[model samples]
Target: MKTTTTMLGLLLGLSAPALAQGLETYAEFPKDTPPGNIAIAPDGRMFMSVHEFYGHALRIVEVKPDGSTTPYPTDAWAHAPQEDGDGLNGVLGLQVDREGILWMLDGQGENQTGRIVGWDTNTETLHAIHYIGQPAARPTSFLNDLAVDREHGAIYISDTGDGANSAIIVVDLDTGRARRVLEGSQFTVPEDTPMIIDGREVKLGGNPAKIGINPITVDPTNTWVYFAPMTANSMYRVRTTDLLDTDLSDADLANRVERYGDKVTSDGSTVDTAGNVYITAMTDNAIGVTKADGTYEVLYQSDEDLPWPDGFAMGVDGFVYATINELHRSPVLNGGEDASLGTYRIVRFPALSATVSGR
Candidate 1:
């Protein structure tokens, strides 16, 4: 059987002497199991959503360090309940705020974008993206990833749309005013196009299959921006001062973006306190890590056995967390059912311990 280990070794990314990287897989699921996004709490708990995206089950599960998992309270918090289909209103994006609040991106699968939700890490208190930027166009344009600059009292969101590719939507976390910035910079799209995944190319519904910079991670010091098109293999960055200025014209901001070293064709990425980037790669099927020197390393190559690694996060004790969504062969990306989809996985590894949290 072709496993993550063999495939990774076949790709020539594995290090010699068996990588010392200590990664342990704590959980697995059966067919139709899809893990949306992952976030880590200071309390050492790992939180993630389930079900195929677009039509979320609105279910969030918390995984213990020892591999046990429990359901988070979605029934008590979801204000917009879903019916008709077995949908929990897909929970696509998740992040932990500076204050330890868990913010979730609820993307309704009815061809409509959904809401941003917040759960108090300490008290389990729930809050939506209220008083901040709401969806620009609901039920269609959905919320994606989130970057909270609590230092500045602002939250930045990515709006992935159907007709419109995407836009950077900012919310005044305190006042609730939402503003759209950088609308048309090789980023947003007006029509749905075809995208290629694995060895097959498929169109996501009618949505464009091209890359439009979906995943974003801020620099530890909040001085720079790192992002990539979920479909592309390279990563890019720009000074955070440029994007946050709000006064800079879209052209000016676009010009400020600096192309960082091409790490790998990555999907989701996160940095530790030490400025090391843990990026997921479909082609590599391993976490392509980039250090401060611009050199890179593949920390663990499928030792825990993953499929289409996607999300990255650093939890308590500076451990790395990742989700294997098996997106590479899905109908949304590939053209049909892929063996990769039958089971879902979450893998963890102890990354370099540094205090870098991208804002």
Candidate 2:
């Protein structure tokens, strides 16, 4: 437990909380983000997904440590352009493997297809090693967020179908095998409403197209899979043993579930090596964490342009990084035809109990 005590003098408010930098804004993309999700690569690179409608080509950008960035450009491996129209729409999720490679949830999208792309850090080359949106079993389900378990070479994604429903899609990176698990659970709906922080109601996204289980995360050891519906207040978790085995159907896996407990209204989630689950409380303007014991706490809050803090991932320096997609702050979310997107801020907070550099 490191305690970083940055002077309240560095930021606004003489009475601001005594801690390390609350939120440090990074990048703010000019595009809209329907539901934002972020991930940190093993090498410290950052990946993000923004705006379901126009989130194709430029949606996912890789940020370097020095702040310079280069787009992971490719029609199939990268985000598809908005002009491609519905048939080729691509909004994605990302994960980094143990070998320092990045894997993408290439939501082949409206075409009812998706692909998992692998990018080699050493070569800066993109490889389409896994493809899911095939004709045999095209569900056209919402392929939202992604989490990878390096131990078993598996990746889990949230289907989040258009019928306002949810399901977990598992990809065996080793075998290129994919399947759905843990279906039909209460936590999969958009109105599960168990999220309670300081007794304040966590407001789920009220957007017309919004529905359940938007953000998904995994425990440190990959034992528990945690997820929440974008508009739902409550949160829940189920064991991975049930999700990984093909013999057990989603209905059967759903039966072995457990409630991780409620959270404030949230948009995205991530976990660290310590078994702590971090959630982006869109309504709280703060990041929340669920400890190993099932109790939760507000880890930090943003004071700057950090209006809507979204997806989160821990960086190499023990800093928790997040995409402050500022969805609510976007014009479309605000009900305007040409809504300006919020700053795609990538802020960092010190690890638990970590104090300011000088403190």
Local accuracy by lDDT, each model:
0.61, 0.61
Cα RMSD of predicted structure 1: 4.8
lDDT of 1 by residue, 239-274 (tens): 656766768887887787765655655567877666
lDDT tens readout by residue for model 2, 152-195: 66778877775344767788877888886545457676663444
Scored against the true structure, residue 140 in model 1 reaches a CA lDDT of 50
Candidate 2 TM-score, C-alpha based: 0.77
How many clashing residue pairs, candidate 2?
A: 26
Question: Cα-based RMSD of the predictions, in order?
Answer: 4.8, 6.3
Candidate 2 residues lying further than 4 Å off, grouped into runs, are 1-21, 26-36, 50-57, 73-89, 134-140, 192-210, 302-304, 353-359
How high is the lDDT of residue 205 in model 2? 45
